[model samples]
Target: MTEALLDEAGLVRWGRSLGEVAAREAVFVALSGPLGAGKTRLTQAACAGAGVSEAVTSPTYTLVHWYTGGRGPVAHADLYRIRDASELPGLGWEELETRPGAVFVEWAERAGDELPPDRWEIRFEFAAGGALRRVRVCVRGCAPPIPDPAVYSAAPEAPSC
Candidate 1:
């Protein structure tokens, strides 16, 4: 498990680091957190690190967004509107599972047991009077290693997703 207290900027840095690693191979990431906890922001940063040039936006209404990055394809999905796991298939969850690049699923708790066993689980929470974020990441089953958020360092330019 990895944990960190990150300002919004730090969160972007950490997310990019993880994306850089995930871009090398396929990985499923499950994100769970309250609204405004930066789940979508992290997904955007990860997409950027994977070399996705187009805009990365929360697929709240559409449910899923697909993009091609330098390494491979990237899939970003949101399950907040879903009340149960059974609805995932309607959104082509199976296809997203087999994607060859990084997959980021926001509001993943809604998927319940339908989520893949081998994946990364990330949880976010507001901390320090909502001025910072507390993020926790853990691997499930035999999932590949994830980058350590503690070691992240921000670049000169401000991060935006």
Candidate 2:
């Protein structure tokens, strides 16, 4: 699925939509984008949609943050600082996938093959004026049904797929 995000609010709305579908067991979400592409912002919103009340911030320095207040456990990881996929093992990458909840990975490309095969990949790119963004979501293996667009008034442009 591909959509156009008019602004940060629209990105958050779309993240919430993804959160609804991600409330399932053992879900993996891979976010790939350049700096300032809104990955962390979307992650925070998705956590909120999943019922998390605590503040969500980028784990860029710490590497990972776990939120259990949501409908289920959510492991948010930032691999931007990691130099190689070999570092994932020490970060509890295995445990995150087997724990029975959702996992969101930012700068996922850095993980290489350490990521699970079944995952949702979201790639973000700057739009014309840099004020907007284009997001593409692709599912690998099995995935839950995407939420209905009618649920969000600020939702992004309809999914291309």
Candidate 3:
């Protein structure tokens, strides 16, 4: 599905809807975008929607960060600094997938074939002079269904951390 994010709140609402669907089972989300494209913000909102209270920030330096206040553990990974997929093992990529929770990867293209086949791919692009953004979301292999936009539009009633 593709959607327009008019503001940060809209992006958060969309992420929340996605988080709701992800809470049902282990899932992988690959985020692709240029610098300052709101990837971390979306992940933060998703974690919040999943009931995680801990602060969610980009794992650009640490590579991976885990949150557990939600239905289950939520793993966030940033591969911007990764030089090769071979470094994934050293970062415990396999173990993260085996956990019962959702995984969100930033700069996922860098992961290459290391990423699971069943994953949700989200691509973001600047629009309207960076005042808005266009998000394209798609699923690969056997992934969970994405929630309808209506679910996100009704942001007032969205689940909270």
User: What shift in Å separates residue 84 of candidate 2 from its native position after superposition?
Assistant: 2.1
Q: Please report the candidate that would top lDDT against the real structure.
A: 1
Residue lDDT tens for model 1, 1-161: 87878888888988887777777777889999999999999999999888899999889998889989886678999998999898877687888876577889999999999888989999998888897888899999888998877665322335576
Scored against the true structure, residue 25 in model 2 reaches a CA lDDT of 50
List model 2 lDDT by residue over 44-109, tens digit each: 888887777889989988888888745777788999988879888767677776677788899999
Model 3 Cα lDDT, one tens digit per residue, 1-161? 64544467788888887776776567899999999898898899889877889888888888889888457678899988887798888786786677778998999998898889998999888877886667778889999876654434322454677
On TM-score, the leading prediction is 1
lDDT comparing candidate 1 with the true structure:
0.85
Best first by lDDT, ranked: 1, 3, 2
lDDT for model 2:
0.77
TM-score each candidate.
0.91, 0.86, 0.87
Deviation of model 3 at 121, angstroms: 0.4
Alpha-carbon local distance difference test for all models: 0.85, 0.77, 0.80
TM-score of 2: 0.86
Q: lDDT, candidate 2, residue 19?
A: 68
lDDT of 2 at 61: 84
